[model samples]
Target: MKNISMKNVVMGSVLAIAAVTSLSANATPVCSGTVAGNGASFSAGTNFVKVAFTPKCSANVFLDGEETSPTVFRVGSASLKGKTKFGGSSVGGSVGNMGACTGAGGVCSGTDSAAAMTAASS
Candidate 1:
């Protein structure tokens, strides 16, 4: 996959799982954190990546910027791999051989440096 600059938006409910697939390049995916909720994890393979998250309803966040995938928020899992803001400011995109993905909703893994932002929840 190749990294492609894009501007996308991911909005959905925070009481389940949402998968936002938006990355064409197979590089290391990074993100940040702002709000808190349920459990969220990230995983990357050779062909694709998985973002398993569990929202619990809290606040609204507007990732005013590049967004990949169509924004999937369920209770099981989701994925991204094309071009966008990854997930939010806390979802430390997928990285090498995968990292110790965090399940905390209001936290970042990489360099996304997340702030106390707000997003619309369902």
Candidate 2:
């Protein structure tokens, strides 16, 4: 009985350690601070890349000065993508007359340093 209990504890510890490590490794790009805006992540394949964002703003997000794919269309929360080697993807949010990608009125705004293309998972 004692041996079995010891084994169980060891196994549990290993699993816990693995879970923590995996979570840290798989952590996606995060955005935080005075703006209190959204978070973003990406999954990339050979032919295409998929990006998703959690909208915490009152407006839309823009990519490369354009309001289109890979950004929410005039709303909150969005998922989109682009082809491989999509180039540098600059991120910003538009909330009313809040300027270009500038977070205001309880919205968070900033540019993501993430690659336009990344690995299979963030």
- Highest TM-score, which number? 2
Across 8-122, the per-residue lDDT of candidate 1 in tens digits comes to 1122321112234322222222221335343233343232335432234222222222223333211111112212222332233221111112325422223221111112111
Top model number, lDDT: 1
Give the poorly placed runs of model 1, Cα more than 4 Å off: 1-11, 14-19, 22-36, 50-122
Q: Write the per-residue lDDT of candidate 2 for residues 22-85, one digit (tens) a residue.
A: 1112223332222334433333322112333232321222122112333211111111211111
Give, for candidate 2, the lowest lDDT window spanning 10 residues: 77-86
What is each predicted model's overall lDDT from 0 to 1?
0.25, 0.24
* Sliding window of 10 residues with minimal summed lDDT for model 1: 113-122
What ranges in model 2 sit over 4 Å off?
Answer: 22-122
